[model samples]
Target: MRITIANHKGGAGKTTATVNLAAALAELDKRVLVVDMDPQANASRRLARPFDRDAPQLTASEVVRSGEEGVAAQAIAPSGWPSPYTELVSVLPARFDLDNRVSEAGTVGAVGRLRRALQGVDDEYDYTLIDAQPSLGHLTQMAFAASQRVLVVVEPEYDSVEGALRVRDFVKGYAQDLGQPDLRVLAYLVNRARRVGEHAFQLEGLADRLEGDVWTPHIPEWTAAKDAASSALPLQICGSARGPEMATLWTELAKQIIVEGAA
Candidate 1:
């Protein structure tokens, strides 16, 4: 399965969800591929080995720019994690130069470039998770066009909720136009949630608005998430006090994704 973790709202934890979920999926003995489509390259930094990015090498930018079949294979590299996890996960890193793809979005067949670049390449992994840039622009469109499903991450705030809704509507309205009629938002994941009044209100509102599409056991506002990112480690292996708890949440989410993908 190819899933894109997306939200137009910055600081909504999209990259956090993508890398940790890849870790959780690897724990289940699944081979995972992470594609970083953000110009910020946050996901690339977290998931890629230091040496991989130390020197110039092929990246997602080249993959999309070339739009050649099976070219993504050349960009794939081992994840930064040690041991078993590193063996199970791979990354297609991106850099700041990925932003250049935006200017080429108006060219003919631009939206399909990524899908074409990734052709026959995903067969090596059980799941491919794409960390899209925090926008609904051309870059994100390329990610969506290549994905089979989208996982929208949001914080419990007005702008985040509105951004999630906009992502839902964008996929619903444009999937067919983009040549992927089966594309859809698989679920809405609430991140950085708390037991406060505002968060409770937003959670309730989201349930009422998006109905069954909202996922259960909302992710809590845990410092471990930030610590893991800072250490460039997966929550499953970050060794923080709450790391296991956070990893459990992601494991559940990964299982849910597995079930949904199988269905």
Candidate 2:
């Protein structure tokens, strides 16, 4: 199964969700491959050594742009954290230079390149999690094309809610433009939800508006998330007070993604 976690707005917890969930799934002994489709390279830096200093070939750009010419042999070094039980989870690193390549691809075939590149490799792993850039650009569209389920991460706020809707529409419209009539919305995850008035109020409104597509179990704000990043450790190894809460979110999310086959 291919799950693409995306949000057009920044700070919606897209990268955090991508890293943690991929770790959680891998912990369950599932072979997972995380494709860092974002040029920010946040995921790559978090999960691997500080990227090749002068080698532009150390990224998915080599595969996506070169048609898998050098993908199979790329060695994905772990981030020095505890390995997930699978020990099979790997990340296709990215770098800032990928932004230039993405820009150079323009609008025409840019979105389709990723899909074509991952074609035969999809079956190699049990799950593929793509962390997309925070924009409705060609790369994001390509992620939508490559994923079987599109998981939208939205914070409980007016702007975030509005951006989520735009992202949902982008997936629908882009599929229509590409003549793909079977695209699906897996669910809208409410990230950083709080046990407060406005958060609950907004969630209620969004629930009514989005209806069945919204995933009820929302993730609460946790300080350990920050600590984990600062310590250069995955949340799975943090064991902070909020660890149980985050674990609950991941377990629920895994059930939603794996058991239900939401795609």
Candidate 3:
């Protein structure tokens, strides 16, 4: 299954979810690769940087900008997580240069270029998660074109929810214009939701408004999540605050993706 985790607004926990879910899937013996399409390279720093700072990188920018040549083969790198997770999880790191080259590289055939690039490694992993930049731009469109499903992560805030809704609507036009009419947001996930009454109300309201498309077991607000980001650890692997919750949530999300892929 190829899934794109996106949010047009920053600080919505897209990268956090990607790394944790990728770790969960990897623990399940599902070979996984996280394709960090975001030029911010935060995911790259968290998952890819800790392993090897000295190795030459093979970022997503190079693959997508390679045109028809299919350079994704060279872009794959092990996440270097130790023990059981070591070989199972890998990353396609990104760098600052990706952001710089976006204007020139994201032109005609941008979607096709990404599709072809990913096709080179399609058979190597059972699950591929594309972490999109926070926008409705060509990079995100290319991610949608390459993915079987979209996972939109939103925090339980007025502005974050609003941004997510706008992205939900934008995907429709993006799919049509990019020739991916079948593309759709398979899951709408609420992230970092506090256990307060107001937050609960907002989540319930979002579910009602979206006709029950909201995913089960929304991620709870936890300091461990922030710690994981800083320590370069997947939330599931942290084995600290809310670790079990993160583990189970991602496991269930992975199950949903498996069901969809089977369908």
Candidate 4:
């Protein structure tokens, strides 16, 4: 399955959700490929790889910009974690140069270029997860273009919820244009949820608005989440802020993805 995690606005815990979810899937013995489309390279950095031309050769930019011929296995790298099978988790790293290239193209259709490139190897993994750039630019569009499902990560804030709604509308419209008429939100993951009553109220409001589409289990604001990011480790393996909660959430997430055929 191909799933894109996107938000028009940043600070919604997009990268954090992507990494931890993918890591959770990996823990289930599923082969997962994470494509880091953000020029900021937070996902790549979290995976312990530099996001620069000097870092590695199989980057998303090279794979997409090189056209059809560029779609090869070399673009993905193992996370270097101590998993029994390192091959279970792979990453298609990106660099800051992606921003410059996309800007020079005059339009963002090239953003969906990653989706076009993915056609070359459709059966290599159990799931393909994309950590999209914050803006609804080419990169984010491409992720939507290539995906059969979308996971909108939203923080418990006004702007985050607002941005998620806009992006949800955009994905609906774009999927129609692409002939994916059945596209539906796989899940709306509430990330960094606080224990404050105000935050709970906001979350309840958002949940009511989104209804059955929302994931009931929310991922709380765990310090280990930050610690894992800084230490370049998957939260499941490196830290213990909310270990039991994370374990249950990921298990539910995996079950949802599997049942929905999103993985």
Candidate 5:
């Protein structure tokens, strides 16, 4: 399945979810392709091999700009993670210049470029997760266009809840406009959740609002996530005290995704 992990609000933990979820899936012996659609390239930097000085020669920028069928095959590379994970997870890295695709949004068929580039390229992978930028802009549209479903991430708070709802509503209307009438929000993942009263209220409200679409076992606010990202390691091996707990949460979520995708 191809899923877009997205939010309209910055700092909603979109990249965090994407990277960790891919790691969790890898632990389950699944092959994953992470397509970094965000120009900030957090996912690429975290997952790509030689992310610093020896960057990828080809990236998602070239794939989308090429707009050619199966061009994504050329850009896909093993992730930076060690051994088994290096073999299980791959990334279509992105750089700062990926933002340039926004200027071509006005061109005919521009929205379908990424989708066209990815055709027949992901058949070997069990899942393809596209990490979109924190907006509903052209870049995000291309990500959405290339996805079969969306997993909306949000912090359990007012603005974040509003942003998730906006993404829900926007996908409903825009998917049809993009000629992807079947594309829909598969689930809402509550990230950075806390035990505070406001968070409790918002979690309840979001559940009531979205009904069965809200995923259970919300991801907690934890320093382990930050440490994992900064250290360029999966939560399973981040060595933080709570890293295993967080890794277990993501693994459970990955199992849920596998079941739902099969359904």
Candidate 6:
């Protein structure tokens, strides 16, 4: 499954969710690949910042910039995450140069390039996660166009609620525009949910609005997440106090994605 985790607003926990979820699924013995679509490269950094500075290297910018066949084959690198299982997951690294490439209007098949690039390697993993940028640009539209499932990560705030809705609409509209009306939001993930007044209210409202499409076992406000990020580790392997809790939560998410996306 090609799942895109996206939100048009920053601080929505999109990268965190992508990294952890891919790690969690890999722990479950799934072959996973994480594509860092964000120019900020936070997901790539979380995977220890694999850079080949000595020679010409493959990055997201180069992958999309290249019209050559099988470019994605060169873009992937082992994630070196030191997981329970060796070679658990891999990441397609990104760099800041992606920002300038994304802004340029020179590419002929701009929005479709990503899908074409990944086609040669899409079957290498059981699941591929795209960590998209925090905006609705052609870069994000490329992700949407290429995705089999779309997950909107939102914090518990009114603006986040609106951002989530916008993402859901983007998937729908993008698919319709591409004549792929079957495409739609596979689910919405609520992150950093708290029991405080506004937070709790917004969570409840989002659940009510999205109904069965909202993922369960919502992530709570916890310092372990930040600790894991700072240490360049996945939450599952960071010895987080919430490790077991998050494991169960993400396993549930993985199964739901498989079943729902399969449908």
* Top candidate (lDDT): 5
Off by over 4 Å in 2: 54-57, 68-80
- For candidate 2, what is the lDDT? 0.72
lDDT for each residue of candidate 3 in 1-263, tens digit (9 for 90 to 100): 78899888888999988988888887678998888888888888778453245866667877777855557878778885666776888888887667655576446676666778877676778988989888877788778888777888988887788778877787776777766787787878889899887787778679666442787778887887877778787777665777767678778877776776567
Model 2 C-alpha lDDT per residue in residues 1-263, reported as the tens digit of each score: 87788888988988888877777777666777788888888877666544776764457766666544234345344344555532666777777666765665564666666666777665777888899888887677777777777788999988888878888887777776643456667788888988888888888868667543777678888897776656545666666777656766776787677876633
- Report per-prediction Cα RMSD to one decimal: 1.3, 2.6, 2.1, 2.4, 1.3, 2.0
Give lDDT: candidate 5, residue 16: 98
lDDT of 6 by residue, 1-263 (tens): 88889888888999888888887787778888899888888998887655657754689899988745568879888885784533878888898888876765456667777788888686878889999998888778778777877888988898888888788777766786643566678888888888899997887667677543788878887888887777778776678788666656777877777677778
118-189: candidate 1 lDDT, tens digit per residue: 899889899999999889999899999999899999899889998888888899999998888999999999
Clash pairs for candidate 1: none
TM-score, per-candidate, Cα-based: 0.97, 0.88, 0.91, 0.90, 0.97, 0.92
Task: Assess the local accuracy of residue 162 in candidate 1 as a C-alpha lDDT between 0 and 100.
Answer: 84
- For all candidates in order, the CA lDDT equals 0.89, 0.72, 0.78, 0.76, 0.90, 0.80
Off by over 4 Å in 5: 48-56
Off by over 4 Å in 6: 50-56, 84-86, 178-180, 210-212
Error of 2 at 114 (Å): 1.0
Lowest-lDDT window of 10 residues in candidate 4? 103-112
